[model samples]
Target: MPLKGSDSDDGGNDDLARLLSGKHAGKHRRRSRDADDDVNGFPRLRSPRPRDEEEPATPTSRRFQHRRRRGFVLCLRTPTAVVLSSAALWILFYALSLEGGDLVSIVARLGILGAYLFLSIALFVLAVLVAVFAKGIPRKTRGGLLAGLAGTCVALLIYDHDESLYHHGGYNALIFALVVMPSLAVGAAEIAIWKWLGARRAAMCHLFALFVAIFVVSARLSRAAAIWGRGFGGETMQPLARTCKPTKIGLPWVDLLPAGAQNFWAGGLTCAPAAKPFSAEIDADGALRVKCPSNDATYIPLPVTREWPQDWKLVEENYEGKLPQPFNKRVMDAIRRTEPFRIRGDNAPGMLVPRTAEAAIVTCDGVEKLVLRARRSNDTSSRTLRPPEQMTGSRQTKTLDVIVVFLDATSRRHFHRRLGRTVKKLEQANADGRTRLFQFFRYSISGFSTGPNSRAMFTGTSPNNLDTVSPVWEDFARARFVTAITADTCQDWGASYNPRPAFHFDHEMYAPFCHADFFAEDSNPLGNFRGPYAINARCLKGSRVSDLALQYAGSVSSAYPDRNTFVLAWLLEGHEGTGEVLADLDDGLVSLLGSLDWSKTALVIAADHGLHMGLNFAFTRNGAVEHRNPMLAFALPPWLADSEGRGETLKANAHKMVSGLDVYATLRGLGKVVDPTGFDDPDVRKRAQGGKNLMEEIVPPDRLCSDAGVPQWYCECY
Candidate 1:
């Protein structure tokens, strides 16, 4: 305590009262007057002046002064706590998201952190500045400071919309909703909280920590449930080719052409040419081995297409044309001359006498040829194989006419090029053959591919070598003389371009003709022919389309069409995502199949590839890759099964691995399609070996030929 009136000299009369109490107030006042007279430094022993000379200060004024000082102190401590707490919370939430936390936890953490940080920081900085510098200042000073700080925060949110802050760990929506919006609300609350607390730093700190703790608990539980409760394998993706060794070996019993068979120079089935031939071999490790000769065909014709046979489209085209010295186009020329029909239908005459109805033959010549029978057609009976000459049911016994339907359902542009080359080779066989010739032959190719005039393979010279190459639609269309109808197909339907658009999956218009007769069956003969047949390599070959047609045309009024003479069509719908197109094609097939006469018609369903839809890779390797399975199916006429001259049966443990190319061989056995060798091998129907045969295990037992009710040739439950 320095002399009370000594300091009071600077503060005015009010400070004199504050420094002195009771009797000291009067003494202090008297000394202040005397001290003023001395003035230079501390008062010397000044004589006491009369107290009447001093004036008194009011208590209200003194109280106001003290409050102003206290307010300043509170502002300093409170604002700092608010701001620091806010910053810490923001950092915590950011870290959690970056650490790959569960989505629910990430969101909850963000919300809690945002609330704490915004409230604390906003209040702290504003209150401290106001208390420190704005004492007795205009209201505009505090308002301007707070408004500026808030504006800065708003700008941050807008600027960060596209930043990683918004998208980290799949938190795009959460950031915008929780972090950004709640920030504004918390900011306002913080300003109010600071002002009410009079810049109490301790209170703001407590509030922020309390908020954070509550959210932390909530976030932890949410994260736990999101991560551990549900499985991540719901969506299975295809494994990358890099992970697995590509297996090139097909079934041994099936006798499939090797991957790069063109380089092979074989004298017979087993004899190799004396010269070393070029070939491609794929080892078990998914590695490719290619041996090239010094002089080889250089110009490999690459097929370009606009639309893929299915929903796929072509986006790129690349080809290098290199021509080698004339190796005989003669072998190719010879095969071109020998044309054999490759269609899906029946091709032989029946030997069994009908017990229920007259026998008939719906020939490919558009003539309904009738076979006078000794018995009714409806009788549960057998039919023997009639000689080729006896198929006409006439004295002259000419070759019988039969229609063949070919489906080329490929969803990718690459497959189109391959299938095109196969068709062209078939035309070559036609040009080379002299014995089997037909006048009214038509091969109509329809599906989604790149174009109407494209070939199916990358090159006709050595196709097996080009299996690694991607396919295009035009390659297949131009290969054979057959005409094709391609839809607006492409390689990819912009799935990579804009994945989240409202209507991203709109490429559903490329399905084949939707007809009921082709797939379904009604009682009408002429009006029921409708078909849904589009080609997509991605779908489950012929069976998928058949199933689709069944769904579209099936109803309570009629059962599936029982046809014997009609050749129905098929489309791979699932591969293309063409929902409407699939529905239409199925309806078309049903109507078409229904209109056909069952007694004189035969329908066959087939597939090019089996999809790997059932694998549970997520259980083992997480969601990684997709694979393809082998094709499988077989059909025989009901009449042939009852009256077979020799009752030959397919193997019991059939691997059920039927190759798509085997359809051609099967046609040759039926005699409707002509093979120059005219050789029929019963063993062709043997199951493919190696993998578990999906068809053998899945097909109903009653449908097998070995069943007592099933005919030898006809494998059906009925």
Candidate 2:
């Protein structure tokens, strides 16, 4: 009831209420009252306006404004949160981009997924911390902190510019910019959000951070699912429905023989001709035109060649009239047992005839020459003679200078679709008359890593034993051939598993860097500047494996133009992350082939192993077969390609079951080197115990994985 200070108290409460509500609240209340005119079907009376249009400031509103300003100052002062958040974001970015780690086992591969999840969680915690600690910092301090962070980011960018992380004109630059810009923007936005939300800023920041973390984790999980799921379902090995059938071996002349001559050789002629007087000559059409005034004369077509006498034979004993009897007998016997021969009229008496000839004649000065020609079992009484059955020598040589190029980690699946241009170019070259010098074969059962496959190829044996392996290069070296092996990675050359001394190469050119160098420095992080992935990028920009191969090839061609050369150019561009360098590899191959004389060189373009990227749908979806399916091709010299239907043989056998061991056998065949394995029987070799020449009969369709020397763990052939 004491009314002494009631008026003062009332006035103070009114001022505090006005201050708490602010002028905007009064305006809102006035607007609400104006909208209630029709509430009782009568206009609501309005209060008279005060002298001042602005409402008086309230204590509550003023206190809130001061508190918001204080919160902004606090956020600006705490710079640690900003630094930690930015670092976390960068770490996440790097973790996602990491490459070159060997995920040999399933567990190791799944660990990568776990690592990504852990990183996302860590990023979320850092973001929430930033929101919580960034309340009430001063503006000047926040500015200073932001400026320092920006400077640090710039320094990092500069330091990574020359490194692999900053790939000019590549996706790396875009990725780097994406990571840096967003992170800096997020830091700046945190300060602004803090000032605006005041007490509610921390809660809102937590929600936003949660959303970002979930987004990143979901993205990573989805990618992991796609990659991991591909290898999860389906049978690991599927049986091939098609069966291998052996192709029959036939005489080369079958394609060239005339219909009438074929029929005559079949059974039209009768006994061998007796000694008689006759004349023999070759017509303009390269047919043997015989004139026997004493008997019926016949003509037989023959292949056109200037070296006639060497491939001819004498038929009659008395035809050696002017020569010694013993010499004539010896010559006749030799001719009967060997390749088709051409007779030199000056050396002996008889006229030139095919070594198959049972009888032949010559009239040097128009007088009848006593000679006899052999005949088939048929009794036509025709003077035409059949060549001896024992004459089986090839006119063209089978040997050639070999060039084996091993492209690293190139899967047949990748090359099958992507290398269309190269394949077309090769096919065109094969059809060209000038370049008819080469033939090609595509192998399908080519897979596995370089270590096992390469060893099989070079040593002509199974990869099961490394100690007893004998490099085919040794044979080439022994034959005075220039043997060269060029590689950028030590893993394929001088590493622990692959000793340098075991491999015999007249010239060895090793690249200064390899995958081993990536893990060489302990201070470097997984995908950092000094890692193998980064070094690979750097190595790609400089003199790469392809460059070394080109240099080695050029040197060999220049130094030993006449001597046969065997080059094993192992290029590394097809390995993971080095795919961008594949074009260079292709260019190097083109240059190498163009620089060499293909007439003498037999080129083999193959891969030591298939792509190990773990993304190939064929291998991943079916069962890890992609790891085993490498690319194999051959470009044989014209002499070998055209001889004994060899080009046809290679084409026919391309689809037959074969592996790197078969390649080894083919190499040995080309070089005429005997296998040290002591298994020389063609039938035994066809069983696939170790090596078998691809040019021979078809590899038996029933040949098992065990017979092929493939371990069960890696074998997919069922």
Candidate 3:
């Protein structure tokens, strides 16, 4: 039986019975009580206590309640929300930091604005599905999705790293840290969020949805700002028309040729052979001897005259110019029918005049010498002229040989590190007066590329067009110097003004002159080598180009020890690879230099451009900075270094602003060629044409890009 005044009494009895039985009781019996009594069977007593009189909560109970509330808030705070917010901030920062112009161009170039919008919408839908069907998604499927996202992010980091951005050290480090660290945090937070959603611990999945929305909005805003600020998708401003007066005078000799002949002479005859003096019989009157080997032809001799006739009356009267022969007909018709033949001067050299043209005015060493034309004949090649005896011979007092070693893409920084010891030894020898051979020089820029830079070095002018003449080799050849070139890379010549057979060099060798079908049979028998190093071990061990160049140089030096020699070895090993290739180059150069007699040689060691390696970050920028500033050093012979204060001047100018043009000018100066002005004037500086002799004059501080022949597109200097 159970006794109870209300349900409370029944519950109390049930609890007691459960405790005694150690099991739940099936039912409890009720016991009746007086209405005045309480549930515990006591008399119905006192009135209810006032609210202010109630006992306070215990410390332990308060703490437990507080912790419960805090836990509820924690459950609502989704990790996904925090990660999304962080990612948004990072993306915003990154987008804003990009160049506005570059961003706008990127949008126009990729043509992906609509696709990007679609991707955003698709991502939003995916996020919605993730929130709504989180519980339904299999554990493995969710994991795979997360893994794919992580992989995509990693790939983006690797593939999309901006080289331009990375070059700016402070911004690069900050942006990299922000992007990578937050990306990792986002991945971790995603895992936590997925677990929470699966376990039904998330209080509000809508928080993640809200975060995704914010992220997308921020990203879009950033991108839009970048594009708008860049000012892309706008019309380009038309350049203002400018009126310029021609500053340079046209050559008198150039004006003498017909329009077609002028074009042919300028374009097609770059390497035409110089005319040699033929046997001639002078008359008793000193200058009136005319003899033709063909048909034993003879014309009446004219009065001996040192000065060219101011008028063509004498020329027309003496040389049967009135005749209607195939050769004389054109000359007579050109003289009489066309504009008056303006005779600029007399005494032009036979070698400087063109043989095929109807007429030409030849000049050499700033002296106009002759006005002449080829006689009528079926064979145009068969032309004869007697050159003055005074014009031939070495112009320089002492024979000076030149060796230009072009290490492709060898950075100055790397050069100093790998070849510092050898260079130091040479410097020490010079300092101790043991050798006066090595003199290290510096250039401010290497020009835009190998082609332009090499052209600038070869010709004393900027490489704007193919018409630019590289007269240095021809000058050397004219002075009886043996000229030769050996190169591992032929692309440089192909890209620039293609080397002409006559003027560029007396001998030229290309590494890949033959087909490689029998490479295994001839060289790399093992067949393990590939890429640029696919040649035989012997060739790779010593540098094939350098070895061949040295052999050629040796042969020329030996054969023409008395005559000057010019040899150019363009080694390709430095274009790529680590220190090993550089080491090979270093050793080869050492051997080559050791074998050469430095006393009579002027050695120029340089690179067309610097290497793109870990070092040389300053010069690795995208614009002209990277292309400029290559390694240039000079080794002058003792004879050339004998000028008073010359050594000190060279040392002082080593760090001065210089270019390949100056190198060209200096080489010309050494070869004793006078400027067109007729004087070997060191003070007459033609900065644009690169006619300033580096050996004689210093570059001014106020030189502008225009003065240096640098195009506006490539000019970085203010």
Candidate 4:
């Protein structure tokens, strides 16, 4: 099409090439208004081209032809202009990444920003007049524009995220109206000035000027409507109006001690001395009663009181009616009955006081001594304080959203690095801090001790402090958290470990021997690469383990409500590195994830510790030196998937080493509070519990692997 009326005027399909062609260059260019040029320059038409060479037509006929042609061309151009402008606006809106809600908000907020923009443009136009007389005006003008661009870039780097830029669909269209319209207005004014100054040609400049004016008017009108619609739609709530939920999961008891007894148990001691064995028993009324079993135990009884600390209350209905306080018979027996001692003297409070003389109340001197105290008491001054009760918040204005993607264990280093990087990206994307979330932990089973006691205290803490350690307790303080909620184990025992190979938490294992599904890391392991739950009595002799896993996931998902507070558990069955494990986990995991409201909860999956596959392919010798196993799988809420600091790349495959500890930092980040107290463990503490160091420590640049083969794949395996 030719540049004007004919197809040739618009030129060939090469739009850009046709635009720059010399044939229509004059129309697009500005006629230089030099000192010699007239205000309305006219050229003599080739000396009238020898007057006789031209033919003349009747006035009426000529007038009719001109009017008809003009009408035809105008009609054609109108639709073309509308189509081109609409397409351009759409591209701009998409590039800017606008969403519908954001678009509406922008329109509403636009009024606030629009007034400033208009005033700014007016000032800019006014300043042009001043610039005409000022020396070095061009340099100053360029400097100001450059400075604005620089500031925008910096602000974006500091606070903007990919997620925020997106509007569900038409949001950005709304934003385009708010932003583009005013911008075009300013641009049009500049173009018009250039045209009048003879710096640009009237034809091309006029076309562009037309384009800008039309868009500006259209965008402003559209954006205004969007903004007004949303504001008029509803009322807004303050952040404080929202309340929190019960943060603690399982309730643990708090301990109290009798009066004066505190002094007798001091001196760096944990229990009462053997000489003065203090015993406690729950009375018929369910109140705790204490007795001194020491000879010459004439010490004053301390004031003993009971108070439920906070979160450690029974959640079930069966154990109602105020479950026996901490000093119950079970605890009393665990403390004193195990130790042997005989009382030689009465340390009882009543035994220390003297009786009144002949039913007459005899009062002593000003001191009014109530008793003549006995001697030879054992001094115990140490006191033990119980952990506080669980914390609760009012109804939440926001809820924690979660996504857990369990990955196969490959290279230890690669896994850890990938795990850490994924978590960092997820946290950065959720800067809103309105959600409480955590990723699957990257732990190995070998690091933990076995047996009922060890299982009860299951965690990756030093052995010496097992009785006093609880990672979950710390996590509750940092983020409302739960782990190993699944019911699968990743370990595979051979004929040697157990003749009739048993699952990690089989009926037998969950009996008196060990009932620690919540605490044990292996309680919920991943499925073997090939089949369902490791053991299915219903299956025939040779069923695939992957099938069992899938069935189990289906059963569990079906058993629970899709919405509610509960942990969905999974155990990757088997320690082998066979490819089957990955396939099985993915299938089962995909199913489980599909069943939840990912926007309101989080999913975390990791191993207790990893197991070593024997070269012989049968369970035999255990490997002492463990690799830095990768902590596989972490998913976050969809909204947070694009938060700032979330790296540009995403993990695609199943090979990377990511540290397990990143779990703590990731959870802290999701919880929205920069400093989470529970991450006080030496490792996570330095980052999360302190300052803004969590991002630095958890998502250091080294963790991202933007290599061609794995743009988001970390390869730090040994």
- Residue range with the least summed lDDT across 10 consecutive positions in model 3: 228-237
**Per-residue error at 488 for model 3, in Å?**
2.1
Runs with alpha carbons beyond 4 Å of true place in candidate 1: 1-570, 577-585, 612-627, 630-634, 642-655, 672-718
- Tell me the deviation in Å of residue 40 in model 1: 54
Q: Is candidate 1 or candidate 3 better by TM-score?
A: 3
Tens-digit lDDT track of model 4 for 125-177: 33333333333335665456435434543443343222121222222222223
Q: 3 or 4: which has the higher lDDT?
A: 3
User: Cα lDDT of all candidates, in order?
Assistant: 0.28, 0.46, 0.43, 0.30
100-152 per-residue lDDT for model 2 (tens digits): 23323322443464344345434544544454456544557556655654564
Winner on TM-score (3 vs 4): 3
The TM-score of predicted model 1 comes to 0.25
| lDDT score for candidate 1 against the true structure | 0.28
Q: How high is the lDDT of residue 181 in model 3?
A: 49
Model 3 local distance difference test score: 0.43
Error of 1 at 314 (Å): 10
List model 1 lDDT by residue over 337-406, tens digit each. 5343221222122122222211121222221111111121122111222345544543223222122322
TM-score of each: 0.25, 0.47, 0.44, 0.27
